[model samples]
Target chain A: DAGITQSPRHKVTETGTPVTLRCHQTENHRYMYWYRQDPGHGLRLIHYSYGVKDTDKGEVSDGYSVSRSKTEDFLLTLESATSSQTSVYFCAISDPAGGQETQYFGPGTRLLVL
Target chain B: EDQVTQSPEALRLQEGESSSLNCSYTVSGLRGLFWYRQDPGKGPEFLFTLYSAGEEKEKERLKATLTKKESFLHITAPKPEDSATYLCAVQATGNNRLAFGKGNQVVVIP
Candidate 1:
């Protein structure tokens, strides 16, 4: 109940189309992360931000990009969508000062590209 | 490389039955371990955090114990609503990154 919301709960797009998903947090946490989950394979980190204007790629950073201009908003964009990118995307936030080292997740956004 | 492996891909238990789920992890320098529960079509919910070996934590009917190599989540007298996927993740020292295991799927039948 830390006030995290993900926009466009579900989306369907065509291959090669550009798509963007939004994640908003009201708690103003310093750390934010983007992850994708698929069947049989567990969740994998896509990108993370340590502070405003500071972002780093994860293991599966190919074909995806993220930006955090404000502390409350983190955006994930797929430059050119691919069928392989179809999965459930999640956004999480954490505060290391308030014992917030543990990440809390959003409701999730399900995406399908055909 | 940090790797995590969970055993018993899927488990089915009847109401009032008790069982345990296993999470085995291999990290270069262990910093922290976490447990999460997730339902179908939803994001994961945090359950516990273990920092050192021989550490144990409990909540309601769930108890988590961590050792040097693996961790176990024990459920006692499970109910029908206890069915969900349990996930394990480990954070390495000096890095703000976490490596997660695939997870253990548990189903409690009424």
Candidate 2:
């Protein structure tokens, strides 16, 4: 649980529509990451934020963008989602500054694009 | 790129049966290996973290051991409550991203 929560636990949208997912944490961790989990693909990173206003692209960052306006809030936006983007999205927080890479994930958001 | 492979996508065992799940990984330089349990429609829950080879960690009915190239999660006398998908992930040195295996689904029947 890690004091993390994701908004819009489930959503259905048409292709080419825009969608935004929110992740809020109370731990005040330094790192926040957005990942998508699909069958046969485990979890793939989409984007991450190390600090407020500081973000980076990850392995599968193509169609996804993230913004961390505050320490406890990270937002993921898909300008135009496609069917391929339909998957279970997860938000994980970690403070690797302590030398541990273990990430704590949120409940998750299930998205379906038609 | 780091690669993680978990064997036997699905496993079923009777209550009180003991078994082990395998997670093999290939990475340029391993920093840490992590184990997580996921239940239906829920996010992954962190279980243990092994920093280096020969490192071992344990919880109530689960024990995790790590090697240079792989890791094993041994379940001792499993129960129906233990049924869930076990995930293994590896974080390479100097990297903040985790490379994870698809997962191993375990079912314990009473």
User: TM-score of chain A for each candidate?
Assistant: 0.97, 0.96
> Which residue ranges in model 2 land beyond 4 Å of their true spot?
none
RMSD of each: 0.8, 0.9
Error of 2 at B79 (Å): 0.1
lDDT (Cα, 0-100) at B67 in candidate 1: 95
The lDDT for every candidate, in the order shown, is 0.93, 0.95
Model 2 chain A: which ten-residue window has the lowest total lDDT? A94-103
Docking class of 1: high
Task: Looking at model 1 chain B, report the run of 10 residues with the lowest lDDT sum.
Answer: B93-102
i-RMSD per candidate, Å: 0.7, 0.6
Q: What lDDT tens digits, residue by residue, belong to model 1 across residues A1-108?
A: 768999999999999999999999999899999999988887899999989999999999999999999999999999999999999999999887667888999999
Clashing pairs in 1: none
Model 2 clashing residue pairs (backbone): none
Stretches off by above 4 angstroms in model 1 are none
Top-lDDT structure, candidate number: 2
Error of 2 at A95 (Å): 0.6
Candidate 2 local lDDT, residue B88: 96
Q: What's model 1's TM-score?
A: 0.98
